[model samples]
Target: MNERLLLDHLLVRGPASRADLAKITGLSKPTVSAALAGMEDSGLVHLAGEVLGRPGPVTSLYDVTAGAAHIGAVDIGRDWIRVAVADLRGRFVGRKDGRNAAKNSEDLVSRVRELAQAAAGQAGLPWTSVITAVVGSPGVYDKDADRMIFAPNLPGWEGSGLGDRLRTALGVDVTIENDINLAALGEHAYGAGHGIANFALVSIGTGVGMGIVVNGELYVGARGAAGEVSFLPAPEPVPADDDTLRHGLTESLAAAPGVVRAARAAGLHLDTAKEVFTAAAEGDPAALEVVHAEGRRIGGLIVAVASVLDPELVVLTGGVGHNLALLGDAITSRFAELGPLRPRVVASTLGDSGVLLGAVARALSQAWDHIFDLRQSGVQPRQSGVQYGMSR
Candidate 1:
């Protein structure tokens, strides 16, 4: 029913000849020619050359122009606000970072505008050239309510319309999502989950989060809060300890803050999670024990994920995930002990840019639809080829 989807269906199936495009989309040859011509003239698509099978002149091949549009991706983490300028092809042309999003959404909006303006200048385009912006946050962002529902870790973000603020400041539409959702989609599109049937992206950072992709699509559970693993209860040594109850149950115990607390009790003056990890690398026995224990705890967590979803692999990302060498074998040995049923664990391929790239990818996907929709003829249905086999 939707022509835009039809055109995209053709574009995704690989470059097609005009006749083949018509055949694939069930559009008349003349209609296909008109659509292709319109798209090429607008600079949204270009000719890639021709086919030898056709008699007379070679047919022209068409491809979507990547630079014709762009998306601004922003990641508002605890310490820094990372922004990236990326084209439709998901290539990041520029990047910039500023202070954290803080308690106030207004400050974040201003910073985003400044960075978006800078990124557009860097890309040799105007702000309007950016189709949309995606902001990834640690909190639960309620899209319809236009508010960040439950983010105690972020002080001034409770009743903010982050999307509206950024859209207003930058003069472009904006979308906000859980940072893990962005990272999960990123891994699925360009990282370890590329072509994998089932995969999970687990990030160990200032907090723990996860993004899940099942059957080749991101699984965003109801209420957009699917992968909130940080609050899942962990086993506590002292059953009746109120302080232990506040620290989180299970998954939170191995997060960055949790690791710091564990190290400090063992006499390490660690100001950040990085220090705790560094101590472990240098064979500080207390730090080593704390980190390795965390690793085993993480492994147990993985067992739950694997058993529930049975993803093909689990990708670990962020500062803590990248330092798997120091976290000890408790994770690997424990997971391995789960036998083949335990999903294989590997480090994230995208490093810190995983969420940034993902936000860019989401923006690009949205823009791709817009670009194709404007071309009009891309939507008309075309015919399909039939192959004859040995008939019974």
Candidate 2:
């Protein structure tokens, strides 16, 4: 109990001397010293440095041994795959990014494995040395079915045994979560949503999705699909087709592809949403019109979210949604036309790293829990061969 308490304090508050730990934890100096000594021997805490030039004897500052264990974070997207290796302190020591030109889900899994190994190698460690890994992808993971669902953007992603393949490919215990949900967590931890108790992250790019944070906690619905807002009906008419049904009305009409489709219809010879946004930035009338229409669609979506969630802020992210400067006016206009409710909206500052950072944060939590569990059971975590989330 003493060691765990001291370690927890160190992890949360950074390095501390014995006297400081004792005073903060309400324990005697001797007790604090004993706990520090025990944790130091177990390779969980270390004397990081010494406070010099003090009025009395030198004070030894102790901290959690951040490099004692490592965790992996993977962000799997339609166009890219990102992997990061982070220490116990949630600091990325190594990272690798690669284009995701996967022809199928199996190829995607293999690509993720390659990137994971490369990232681990950059940190001077083998991939197997990572204790836990969290994978952020486009859809909610169905635990009972052991597959992903509602991820039409990524072809073959909803197939059966997808989770098993990821675990096998990575050779580690993996936790799969919705990428947008992770982005919300990332913003809360390190971006625009920081210090906000309640907010929502709505991503509009290849697909549209929302992640809800209520009372500073991620709120996934009963089926882990709390913020799947893409299925919401749009104000404009939607064609009844297989593609439209697969991606839902709102997504089909508001996402990047929708922006491109609208641009093409407006006589703008743009192939990608990026090109349309670029053209709009360069003062192209046709492109600007398309962007404004897309923004209005997003505005309606935000109004819907605000009616139900009433979040403190809504963070806009993803390839297309991050263009807040271009979309702000139209979004505000549509908000006024829709209703009297006005929700705070901001662009995500974390950019492409939001999901990856959130994955690292979650993996760190899991690593800490697993390490302490082993310690409580009288097993040295460094010597324990059991992987995280696995039965001993």
Best candidate per TM-score, number? Answer: 2
Write down the lDDT that model 2 would get: 0.90
Error of 1 at 266 (Å): 1.9
What lDDT tens digits, residue by residue, belong to model 1 across residues 170-248?
7766788889889988888888888897989888887778899888887888897777776676744634365444434
lDDT of 2 by residue, 1-392 (tens): 88878887987899999999999999999999888887787788898999999899999999998888889999999899999999988899999999999888998999999999999999998887788899999988999998899888787889989889998998888999999999998998889988999999999988999989999999998999999998899779989699898888999999999899999889988899999999999999999999999889989999999999999899999999999999999999999999887899999999789999999878888888887777777775446655433432
Off by over 4 Å in 1: 1-31, 48-59, 101-103, 237-248, 336-341, 372-392
Global lDDT of each model? 0.74, 0.90
Candidate 1 at 106: error in angstroms? 2.0
Q: What are the models' TM-scores? A: 0.84, 0.96
Candidate 1 lDDT trough over 10 residues, lowest sum = 383-392
